[model samples]
Target: MEVVRSKEFIADCSWGAKDLASMNGISTRLHWTKEPYKWHVNDGEEVFVVLDGKVEMFYRIGGAETSCILESGDIFYASVGTEHAAHPIGEARILVVEKEGSV
Candidate 1:
């Protein structure tokens, strides 16, 4: 129900990097130097776009772990059923729209 501009959001660039639509069930996340960890989707899918730095996203497909490195301007996504995780290979800024009602 609002607009976010990355170049202006002073505290967290990830929160303001994109203009997000108010979804039926949705949320957003911004990770900085908080922690180096992996994550997985419990229910729905999420679409992400890297604003800065680099992130390595891994997912298990066909019993194989597939990896992809996302950099600035890179747009990537994972579905609800995908067994995936992500960690900052280096420093990274990303915007994610996570499906609401999901863990």
Candidate 2:
């Protein structure tokens, strides 16, 4: 068994993460970031949860761009081939679940 205090978690670099659990080909991770991530489409589906702070999430739909702000406890689900990016309002902690080895 393992315990993680999300608010107290920090990483040496932006988007750095700690593995929390894995089953089959899926993994759960805690990520700390203060910078925006590059827009890209995941090969598989992804589940993103804001654990602390705020994030402005951007995504492309049919060549059009749209975004939304996510606060603590907000969840974002990205299906396969969904182009998306996440920009932290400041320092933020996020919980991510996706296929193992996906980026």
Q: Each model's C-alpha lDDT?
A: 0.64, 0.97
What TM-score quantifies how close candidate 1 is to the native fold? 0.69
Count clashing residue pairs per candidate. Answer: 1, 0
Q: What is the lDDT of residue 80 in candidate 2?
A: 92
Candidate that scores best on TM-score:
2
Compose the digit string of candidate 2's lDDT tens values, residues 9-30.
Answer: 9999999999999999999999
Question: Which residue runs of candidate 2 sit more than 4 Å off their true CA positions?
Answer: none
Could you give candidate 1's per-residue lDDT for residues 37-64 as a string of tens digits?
4556557777877776777878898879
Task: At residue 73, give the lDDT of candidate 2.
Answer: 99
Which 10-residue window of candidate 1 scores lowest in summed lDDT? 10-19
Against the true structure, whose lDDT is highest? 2
